[model samples]
Target: MEASKRQETARAPALPWTVRFQIFGLVAAASVAQRLNGTVNRSFFSLVDRHVRASARPDKFGVRSDDVDVDASRGLWARVFKPSEAQSPLPVVVYFHGGGFALLSAASVPYDNMCRRFCRELGAVVLSVNYRLAPEHRYPAAYDDGVDVLGYLEKNRLQDPAVQVDLSACFVAGDSAGGNIAHHVAQRWTAAKSKSIRLAGTILVQPFFGGEERTESERRLEGVAPIVNMRRSDWSWRAFLPEGADRNHRAAHLTSENADLAEGFPPAMVVIGGFDPEKDWQRRYADLLQQKGKAVQVVEFPEAIHGFFLFPKLPDAGNLVKEIKAFMDKSKASASSA
Candidate 1:
């Protein structure tokens, strides 16, 4: 909650220099036009498209899995990752990739790296759901895909003798747009009673839940260099919704109503960026959960900006990972006790 500083040093020339350099340059460029109109968002998406395609790494961070289908109607792409250790029913995390809901896919470098880390570090099975993106798919499309996949796992495979999924310790997580999806999906799961599911928690990193106007932190950090600016946030909302859907619409804000908060809101850990325009909303949502008597852990990286969690090479990134691990550990323990 306190103001802080990021320990930024000259870009390190490291082994994965290509990936690091690309991210470094992109962040630097974004910092320059952080508040530029929609132009910066357009350029950022363009760069993301090119970078995601080129930075795809299928070999490193080895984990094993098969091409599994979650939803056929919307063409949901899924990849399962299981740890190398001999099989035990492993916890499952249904992950949604982030690209402002329109740009990147599951194969995106940052998402791929995250999926790898979750599977390897926690020894949990990860199901990365490549949900349909926006512009072509639009508002409810992403949300629908996310909920449907969770429902599918709950109904069909959670109890399947061969599934290898820890029915008692499952989770839903995503970042950015994916974080938004995780919020909605978790709500739906709780609402439906999802009898077969024993969801542990959700992880939302810098989630977007704006309703028309920017929050206090958003307004104050309007032009913070190397961070997502107000204009870019607006662009993402507009790009992800239907032609007529208003960003200010109550439905657009995940915490628009107490009813949406639901009873037994599963334990959650929401990571926010001090410089993220959406930080205030993220805090508001977490507070709402706490008010509901739900266990909520909020980790705000005061020194970092949006997407800081993606750069694992940076010192801040490494520290963020450690925080994330602690959060996950607590979540898993809470799930077991419940």
Candidate 2:
């Protein structure tokens, strides 16, 4: 029996480099800390944060950035990026960063690079929001922060002299958990019937959403994705959601029953990675939006994985940006005609 087990072990396939590195970091953290505790988790993620920050080589070619506090009481802030050469007021993109609702920051290296790219490529002012994270501030806190940032932008546009923003051309965008927040924020904005700023469109990049029932893609890609897996995603849901709430919560998971919330949503661009476990649900949401008569565009990157936008070197990353630009331009034209 032992000899057979050894033979089976030897025949097992090797994990991908990304998975191996992730496991190695977790193992090293456990070994060095002598225990698996919150402190160790934070320490390990901090190292990852540092690494990501280091890799963020800012491309400020045609863009200039500035930091501003949106609401000090709520500890909300944003890093605003504007195209330097644009003489006229440009559209605004209020962006949120993805970290499973518990990790990453708007000021992180990847997010900074993303904001810079959006500013330069779209010729727009990108307001990358820094909302409070969860496990410290639960569910609705992040959602409320998103709405607050929009309100602040609408009311205080003239205060920032660095960039002239066209409120009529405003849009909200985010990746992963940020995408989830953007969805909720758009709903809130539409519900409020605010005429101060019209949301021309929304871009959801690999939005992180799930439900009590497992998705087919989730089952198929359970342990497959290099960075995100079933276990990690489940942990994030538990950590960020309100206590006693399950994945079925409307805010956490978008279902057909509540699809009405998307009825008045601005034109949307839903970007999904084929290899992502969340792909099924993201696609479903896009279809729901389309069915509701909302103008929606679905862009899929068959070779990409979750959070692929962070890696600008990937071919799909540039294509995703171009898709966003096209969507924005279409929305802009529609808004003008309307």
Candidate 3:
């Protein structure tokens, strides 16, 4: 009997490292290690990012892409994508890639592919910003990088004929952390007195925001979602924000106190997942925007979870693209009429 049991145990396949770590609850341990050892974490995260980014499909479908440095001194860069057949100037989408403000880049394969899809579907020139990540670059750094990218686009509008972007119809879009950055950038653009480019709209896909108080969704989905969980979300906040800063910081929480700032924001489309832990906050933000008399629309994926758009094969991904296209079309119509 003992020999039979030993043989059966030996027949079981070994689990992958990631699976093993998750099974043993070492994932959180690694996150703690990341907070303690910056170099090690950066190296590990970079390796994973490289693998993921390498999986991006080649730029086919008549979309042309070029890497451009927005700010040499600050190491700010962007990947610009435009449809090859666009004769007239195309609407500009200043896109930000999401990785909890610490992982991934604009150059990542998933992000690059996403930008290509945006260019193809919306018939718009997409400038995907490669903002610096955190633990190395903390809060307001990414936000500043976003503003600088916009400023660079405004100053160098005609630098590339192949990518002639319509600055007047500029829109901002992002998912997760990128969504949060997009919102902040739009607010800053509205407040800036010397703004040159005009914003037509903002699209936020599953924005990552948190406060000192936990929402029911967060409590229910803690350590539950396949992509993002409460613990991971909390860890990201710690790594991205200034040292010792809490969730109540304005950078994390867009509260009623600062709701007035959103008044000048352009029309916005806030997308949220029904199962996302951050859905409550995202909904609150949309409501706040509406209450402030700002034009806002909310789109909910009732059966989806966070990061659904990242997976192109998912049915929700196609639905999201269609929704965004419709919104942009409506905005364009409004702009033409005005």
Cα lDDT for residue 328, candidate 1: 68
* Tens digit per residue, CA lDDT, model 2, 1-338: 97685344233223456655654564344334322232225565656564232222334385667778888887888888876545678999999898778777877777887788888888888889899987778889999999999888888984545457899999999999999999999989988888889999999999888888888777766656556767666667777787878888887777678756634579889998877888888988888787777888889887677877777756788998899999999999999998
TM-score of each: 0.80, 0.86, 0.86
Q: Going through the candidates in order, what is the number of backbone clashes in each?
A: 1, 0, 1
Off by over 4 Å in 1: 1-62, 155-163, 255-259
Q: Enumerate residue pairs that collide in model 3.
A: 53-109
Tens digits of per-residue lDDT for model 3 on 45-129? 5544542332223355887777788888888988888776557888999999987888778887778888889989988888899
Best by lDDT: 3
lDDT of each: 0.69, 0.78, 0.79
Clash number for candidate 3: 1
Give lDDT tens digits, candidate 1, residues 1-338: 13332222112223255544666676555444333332234466556444232222334554655556776666886766665443577788898877667666676667666677777776677888888866667778888888878777767663434337776778888888788889888887787776677678888888877777666666666555343666666767776777777786543575535336657568888888665667788888788778778788888776566676677755666776677678767877866676
Worst 10 residues of 1 by lDDT: 5-14
Worst 10 residues of 2 by lDDT: 31-40
Over 4 Å off in model 2, which ranges? 1-40, 51-60, 158-162
Error of 2 at 264 (Å): 3.4
